[model samples]
Target: MRGLGDHLTIGERIAFYRKRRGYTQEVPAGLVGRSTDWLAKAESGRRRPPRVDMLAELARVLRVPLGDLLGQSVLLEDDNQLDDVPAVVMR
Candidate 1:
């Protein structure tokens, strides 16, 4: 499946990445220390997005950069390239 559009809400982004990575709700939910029902609600926009700390964990588990899930522009650089962009610290 295609990735989520730039205009999608956070909930949609989460669901999109989850599906793209071929993970069922139970898998990611458990990995992120959340219940499958909570994940379902979050994906459907029935619940608020995960907390910032949880967001990082989600990104790690989903194998996506945090910026992608957070709807921010991500800069990809090789090991030899130095990234000049300011880092966003999710607190």
Candidate 2:
């Protein structure tokens, strides 16, 4: 099966994870100290990806590891699973 990280834009990836984690735009935006409109613009590709510093906070709010949020290879300690997920490079 194809992973969520495949061939998706940064905005799309963010939206995907956000939805997978069961968070509305308002919930994560508040947790990450961003406005709902900012998250909407980001998810819609109207704005750039969040800053690097904010990525960690976003991951935290979304209940995923930083690597997962960044779409990088993440090592799962419990099962020793390694996922080679492609990252969406923000311009």
Mind sharing the TM-score for model 2?
0.73
Model 2, span 1-91: residue lDDT tens: 0365356655676788898878889999998888999989988889888775687688778776666656565556677553443454667
lDDT (10s digit) by residue, model 1, range 1-91: 1354568766688888899889999999999889999999978978777776687788889987767777776565787342433353433
Model 1 spans > 4 angstroms off: 1-4, 74-91
Clashing pairs in 1: none
Q: Cα-based RMSD of the predictions, in order?
A: 4.3, 4.1
lDDT per model vs. reference: 0.76, 0.73
What's each prediction's TM-score?
A: 0.75, 0.73
